[model samples]
Target: MELCFFDQVKAQPLWVQILLVVGTISILKFSFAVLNWVYVTFLRPGKNLKKYGSWALVTGPTDGIGKSFAFQLARKGLNLVLVGRNPDKLKEVSDGIQAKFGKVQIKSVVVDFSGDLTEGIRKIEEAIEGLDIGVLINNVGISYPYARFFHEVDEQLLKNLIQINVEGTTKVTQAVLPGMVKRKKGAIVNIGSGAAIVIPSDPLYAVYAATKAYIDQFSRCLYVEYKKSGIDVQCQVPLYVATKMASIKRSSFLVPSTDGYARAAMRWIGYEPRCTPYWPHSLLWALVHMLPEYAVDAWRLQFCLAVRKKGQLKDSRKKE
Candidate 1:
C-alpha cells in the first residue's frame, strides 16, 4: 500500500480553514468587505426623524448620492439648498428638484471643494449670508483615479482628498454648528462609506479609506457630545452607492443605486443614531467581522489581481 503524503490530515485546523475561505472570498468578492462593514457599523439603530430641519443645506449636491439626498429632502417638504463645485450640474439637479417638488424652495450654491476648503466654505457663508441655516448635510467626497495607489498619488490629489474628506467637512460643520446649537434644533448627517469601518488592506484606495475612517470616528463623537442640545449628528455608511464614485464596479451586490442610498439616508432623518441604509446586509457583515487580520490581508491580494492595469487606451475606465 502506497501512503500519499498530500492526503494526510490537513496542516491547518478546521477553524483556520474556515477563516481562510472567508478571507479569500472577501478579497475576491467585494460583497465580503461591504457586508462586513454593514454589520460592524450599521447595526446601531437611529433617532427620531420626524423633526427635520426646514432649511436644509446639502454639499456635493451635483453628483452621485448627494444629488439624490437634496432631491429627497425637497420631496419631504424641506426647503433645500444644493451645494457643490460645479455650477452647471448644480443648476441641473436644482431645476429637476424644483420641477418635481415645485412648491419647495430650492437654491444652488457652487464652490470648489478641492480648493482651500475654508475659503470655499466662506463663499457658502456668503451664499446664505447668515439666514439662520438649519440642517447641514456634509456630503462632498472624491476618490481620485482608481489606478493611483497611496505612494503613487500626486501631491495635488492627496491634498484634494484631504480637503474634501477632512477639512471641507470640518469647516462646513464648524460654520453651521453654532447656529444649530444656538437655535437648539438641527441635524448634521455626514455621508460616509463602508470603507471607513472595514479599512481594507487593498492599496488601490488606501487614502480614500483613511479619509472615511476620520468621518466615522468624527461623527460618532459629535453625536455623543451634542445630542443633549437637540443637535443630531449621524453617519450613513452605505455600500458603494453608484455615483461618480462608482468608477470601480457598477452593479455588484456591494454597489447599489444612489437613489437607494438616498432613500436609506432619509430613514435616518431623525436618526436612531447610526444605521446602515440596507438592513439585510447585516448577515454578510457579521461573518466578515469574525475574520482574523492575517487572513484578511492575504484575501486582499486576490482583490489586487482582479483589478490590475489592463492599460486599455481605447476608453479609460473613469466616467465623466
Candidate 2:
C-alpha cells in the first residue's frame, strides 16, 4: 500500500502534488482550530464559583456590565460586596438584588475611583473585612466621553482616565489580594477593552487604550505570580458592548447588551488569563487581526474623527 501511494504521487505533476500536500495540511490545521474554539466557547464546563468562596465583590456595580454581573452573581447564590461611587446607586442595586434573591446576603461600599483612590480602596477593604470574597471583579473603569485627539484631551479628563482606569484597578486589586493570598484561593477578573487588544490603534481614545493595555499586561503578570497560590487572575477584553460609555444604547448581534456580555464573561472566569468572552467579539477580534495593521490604524483614525465631529456638534447643541 505504501509503495502504491508513492507510485501514485510520483505519477502526479509536481505542482499538483505540492498543492495536494499543502491543502491537506491546511484543512487539518483549520479543522482542529475550529473544534477547539467550539469546545472552549460552548462545550467546556464553567467553574463552580461557589467553590472559590461564598461571597463575590464587584466594583462599578450600579450600572452596565458591573450591574449585570452583580445580578448574575446573586442569581448563582453568591453573597455580594457591591462597590460603587454613589451610595444611593449602590443601595439601589443592592436592594434590587436582595429583592430578587432574598436569601442572598449583600453589602454595599461607596468608592469613587477617580477621587482619592486610597480612601476608596480603604472602604473596600473595610467592607470586605470578614467576608470570604472569592471573586473580585475590577469592573470599574472610565473611557472618553467621546473621541478626541490626544492634544484635544483636557487636563481633567486625562487625569480622571488615568486615575480611574489605571490606578483605581491597581489599588483595588492590592486591597483584595492579601485576603485571597491568605485564603489561597480566589478569582480576579479585570475588565479590559478591545481598544487595546483587538484593534491596531484607538486613535482619539489614546489614553483609555493605553490604560487598558496596562491592565492586560498587569493581569498577565499576576496570573503567573498567583497561579501556584490558587488565585486565578484574568483580563477580559470585550468589544463594543451596548452601554452608556460606548454611547451605544441599543444592543445588537455585534454589540452585546451588558447583561449578555456579563453572562458570557462569567463562563470564562478562572480559565484563560486573557480572553474575549463574548463569542461574537472573539470573531470580530479574529477578523481584525487578519487585516493589515496599517489599514486598521487608518480606519480607526477616520472613525474616531467622525465620532469627534458628532460629539462636538452635540456639545454645541447643548450649549445652544
Candidate 3:
C-alpha cells in the first residue's frame, strides 16, 4: 500500500496535470463571469444624462488623461476648472486653451489631492462656488514606489494613492453629486484600466490597478443608484494608454495614446458603463477578456509581479 501511494504521487500522469490546470481555469472563468454579472446587472445601475450642463471641473488637468479631457472638453465649448498640483503646468495648459478657443473660462487650482486630501477637496468646493457645476471628472491619480509587494509599498505614498484614488474621488463625487441630484442632471466619468478587467500578475502597479478596479466598481454602483435622479456615472475602462502612470508597460501595441482615449471618452460621455473606445480598443479588451481565465490571470501576474526589481518613483530631475 505504501509503495502504491508513492508511485501514484510520483507519477501523477501528464494528462492528470493538464486536467488539473484546465479545471482550475474553468473555475476561474466561472468566477469571472459571476463578477461581470454582479457588476453589470445586480451591482450597479446604468445611469444616463442627456444634459450635463456647462461648468465642468476636471481634476488631474495638468497631465496625461486629465490634460486630454481638458483640451477635448474645451474644444467642445465647456468652461474648465483645472485641478492639479502644478500651477505652472496648469497655467500652460490654460494658456494653450485660450490661444486656440479664444478664452474658454479657464481656471486652475494648485492643489495636490493626495496631500491633505480632505482640505484640498474642501478648497475645490469653495473655489467653484456660485456655479451650478454639472460635470465632475475625477482624473487626478498616480502609481509608483514599487519596492515590495502590496504590503511593502511606501506607507506614505500608498496612503497618498489611496487618498487621491479612493478618498478624494469619493469626496469630490459626493460633493458634486448633490448639485446634480438637486438639479436632476449631472455627469460623472471615472477613468479605469484594462488591468481591472483581469487580475494582473504584474506587481508593478498592483495597488494602482486595484484602485482603478475599485473606481470601476464604485462608478457602476453610483450609476445604478443615481440613474433615476438624472445623474450619469460612467466607468470608462480603456487599456494601458501611453501615460506617465504606466511607464513600465510601454509597448507600441499595448499602449494607446492620450488623444485616442480622449476621443473615445467623448463618445462614451453620452453613454453609460462603457468598457469603451469600442471600435479598436474594445477589440483588444475583448480578446483579453475572452482568453481563458488562468491564462489571463497568469499574464497579468507575469507582467506585474516582475516589477519589484525596477527602481522606485522619482521626481523629474530636468532643470526647468
Candidate 4:
C-alpha cells in the first residue's frame, strides 16, 4: 500500500521523527498563542460595571492613569469615589466627571498614601460606608524621581515607596474587601508595572520593581481566594504610559496616553489575574521576553544608567 505522510514520517529515522514531532508541537503552540492574543485584543466583550455594582473607587485619581480611570469609569455609568492626596485636585477631577457625565454621583476622599495611612485609611472606610463599591483601583503609588543604585536610595524614598505601594494597597484592599465579600461581587484592579513582570529584571530601580512584584503576587493570591465569592482581582501591568510619573511628555505608539491606556484597561478588568491590557504594549512585552536574559539585563542596565545621568544633571542645574 502507498504510504501516507504520517506513515512516511514513521518510516524515517528515529531522530528525524522526533525532530518533526517537536517542530509540529512548537508550531501548534505558537499558533494558539496568536489566536488567543487576537481574541483578547479585539473580540472579547468587557463585563458590565453595573453588574458588579454602581460605585467604583479609584485611588490617585488626580493625575496620570488614575485620573483617566476615574473618567472612564464615570463614562461607564458608575458612580465614583475619587481618592488622592490633594483635595483640590480630587475635587477638580470629580467636577470634571460630573460636568461631562451629568447625573453621575461623585465623591472625593483625601488620603496621602505616603503619610500616616492609619487616619487616611479610616477616612476611606468612612467615605465608602454603606455604599456598594463594586470596583477598587489600587492605583496610588510612588516611584523614584530617577533610577539610582540600591545603596544610593535615601531613607525617605525607600520608606515612601514601601508605605505607599505595598502597605497602602494592602490596607485599601482590606478596607473594601469586606464589603465585596459580604455582597458577593466585586472587582479589584491593582496597577503593576512591566519592571516587575515583562523584563528579566530591573537593574537600578530595585525597590520600586520589588514593590510592584509584591502587587503582582498579592493580586494573584486574592484572585484565587476571592473568585468563589464572585470577586475578580487582577494586577494590570503596563510598560509605559505618557504620564508625569514616567516623565514622558508625549505619547507614542509604544507609550499610550493616560486616557488611551485607561480605556484599554477597563475592558480587561475582572478578567485575568495578570494582564498587559494595552495591545501594542503586549507585542513589545512579547518581543522583550523573546530576547536572551543576558541581553535584556544589559539593555536595562544601560538604559537606567542614562536615566541616572540625566537626573543628576538636572539636579546640578537646579543647584546652580
Question: For every candidate structure, what is the RMSD over all alpha carbons to the true structure, in angstroms?
Answer: 9.8, 2.0, 10.5, 1.2
**Consecutive 10-residue window with the lowest summed lDDT within model 4:** 1-10
Candidate 3 residue 113 Cα shift, in angstroms, is 1.1
Give the better candidate number (1 or 2) by lDDT.
Answer: 2
Q: Identify the superior model by TM-score, candidate 1 or candidate 4.
A: 4
Which residue pairs of candidate 2 clash?
A: none
Writing each residue's lDDT as its tens digit, candidate 1 over 214-254 gives 88889999998899998888887776566766564464566
Question: What is the C-alpha lDDT profile of model 4 across 230-253, one tens digit per residue?
Answer: 999999999989999999999999
lDDT string, candidate 2, 64-114, tens digits? 999999999999899999888899999999889999999999988888888
Go through the candidates in order and give the clash count of each: 11, 0, 11, 0
Which candidate would rank higher by TM-score, 1 or 2?
Answer: 2
Q: Report the C-alpha displacement of residue 85, candidate 4, in angstroms.
A: 0.9
- The candidate maximizing TM-score is 4
Give the 10-residue window scoring lowest on summed lDDT in candidate 2. 113-122
Full-model lDDT for every candidate: 0.73, 0.93, 0.74, 0.95
lDDT of 2: 0.93
- Candidate 3 has its poorest 10 consecutive residues by lDDT at 311-320
Better lDDT candidate (1, 3): 3
Rank ordering of all candidates by TM-score, starting from the highest: 4, 2, 1, 3
For lDDT, candidate 2 versus 3, the one ahead is 2
For model 3, the local distance difference test gives: 0.74
Please list the residue runs of candidate 4 whose C-alpha ends up more than 4 Å from where it truly belongs after superposition: 1-3
